[model samples]
Target: MQIVSALSEISDRYDALFVDLWGCVHDGVRVIPGANEALRAFRAKGGKVILVTNSPRPRAGVERQMDAFGVARDAWDDIATSGDSARVAMYRGIVGQKVWHLGYAGEEDGGFFTPPNVLDDPLEIARVPLDVAEGVVCTGPPDPSAHPDVMRPELLLAKTRGLKLLCANPDIVVDRGDRREWCAGAIAKLYSEMGGESLYFGKPHPPIYDLARRRLAKLADVPDAAILAIGDGPLTDAAGAMGEDLDLLFISGGLGAEETGTPRLGDPDPEKLAAYLEATGVVPTFVIGSLR
Candidate 1:
């Protein structure tokens, strides 16, 4: 992977960008400095940016979260969230009508139960207890700081009943301004390990990319070759881009900052970056310390 100084070096090569939110644009809690300006600059150049995120909030909720985080509206053209994509599946009754709602303990109204605009005949979803539910809809850990194994009792019961879990977000852990928290993917991974089926809809999965493509189509008919995927998650962003046959601008300074030896506003050490990428088994098209 080529280590680049800034996004501008390769921004002109693509007509659209499937930029990730939690890391590339914001550090989960707030807008990362330079990210908004970088995106605004790209938009001014006639490029469309789709904030393709694995956030467990619906697109509307995502917009609200962005607003609350002080993330500029002009920085992006549209959004495609894992919550919306998974909600479509949930409303379609992929996990049956009576399912358990697993989400963050104190997260705001995330619109996870809202019907997506795409469905014409959506089923009524009811959140039931795990012992009596048909399936599980896991948005994330009930407590972000708690260990994922804390929910093993519920998952074990669900597995015994042969329930399929719809994992809304596929991120294992996210750094919320230096505090790392477990996500839905970790719960789903544990479930799968315990012989329960976990259905993923976000990054590293084709469903979210398909949703993103539909959203991008509204703004421009950009080809995959002309659309660059930017994110900090090596497994989600890098793997998703590779799976979708799209080039990636891996932002190492977000999640793997320490591992890659990346400063807060500088490029990663080439040798350390190489070793990290090798360990992760991902080769991004380009690498940048931050969005700028």
Candidate 2:
């Protein structure tokens, strides 16, 4: 549990790196300063880097977003996203099954599937017979204003019907440029709390890490022991790394709401960092202000 300044310190030790996208490499809108340089340096040293993200968009869509933000595809060896993973899971079972999607209407269609029934209105869909559907998938952002009392009737419907809830993204909340918004995982978590069953398909889950590792193995001759997971979020990236038994390099410049003065946990203070970690019980192997 030591602090480091840059990725170069551990570059030689790790043959591959699974880097988080949103808060670590870039904000929602723009790439972080020196992030590209750090990746280039890692590549120069013959290290493979994979962009691992919890974005609910498909791999191609995520790449398009990266391209739009000037993040070159050549910077990373591969890209794996929760949306892509979920799509794979969905199609692997129950072809042509009815799915009640509970996110943004069009967002889930990126690569997931065009189910027989695509219900944008949760209330309208709830009135229909739930026995007709195979399962429920949460892929879009929740609209709190859609209902005053309860914003998630879809979860209730899924629970009542004893249907499986597939959560595409495991991130509870993400920093969209400057605004923080609840993603599909938040709703999935809420449903799980209410005695609902959900299958998560993102970071903090072993499958996504396995996919990244498999892809990395093809690009680099590094052992699993020589791979590192670098990210800003403790819950997703750090926890995922620890679960996979990989090294961790934490970026603390993003994802903190309070401007406390610490610079390690994105808190402006050490006390804040300690408090946050104590509450979450997520401790990283190394910490730094930024990748630079």
Local distance difference test, each candidate: 0.91, 0.72
Model 1, residue 101: what's the lDDT?
84
Tens-place lDDT digits, model 2, residues 1-292:
6667677877888878899998877788887777888898888878889999987777767888887787766678788887777766666552124666767534433554532222332221221234577677778555723321264565676788788878888887777776777777777788888788889889989878877877777776777788888887778888888888888876767664353244432323567666765676667777666766
Over the full model, what C-alpha lDDT does candidate 2 score relative to the true structure? Answer: 0.72
What are the models' TM-scores?
A: 0.97, 0.85
Number of the top TM-score candidate: 1
- Candidate 1 matches the true fold with a TM-score of 0.97
Clash statistics: count for each candidate: 0, 8
List candidate 2 stretches off by more than 4 Å.
94-96, 104-110, 114-131, 142-149, 257-268
Q: Residue pairs in steric clash, candidate 1? A: none
Candidate 1 local distance difference test against the native: 0.91
For model 1, residues 64-104, the per-residue Cα lDDT tens digits are 88998889999999999888888899999999999998884
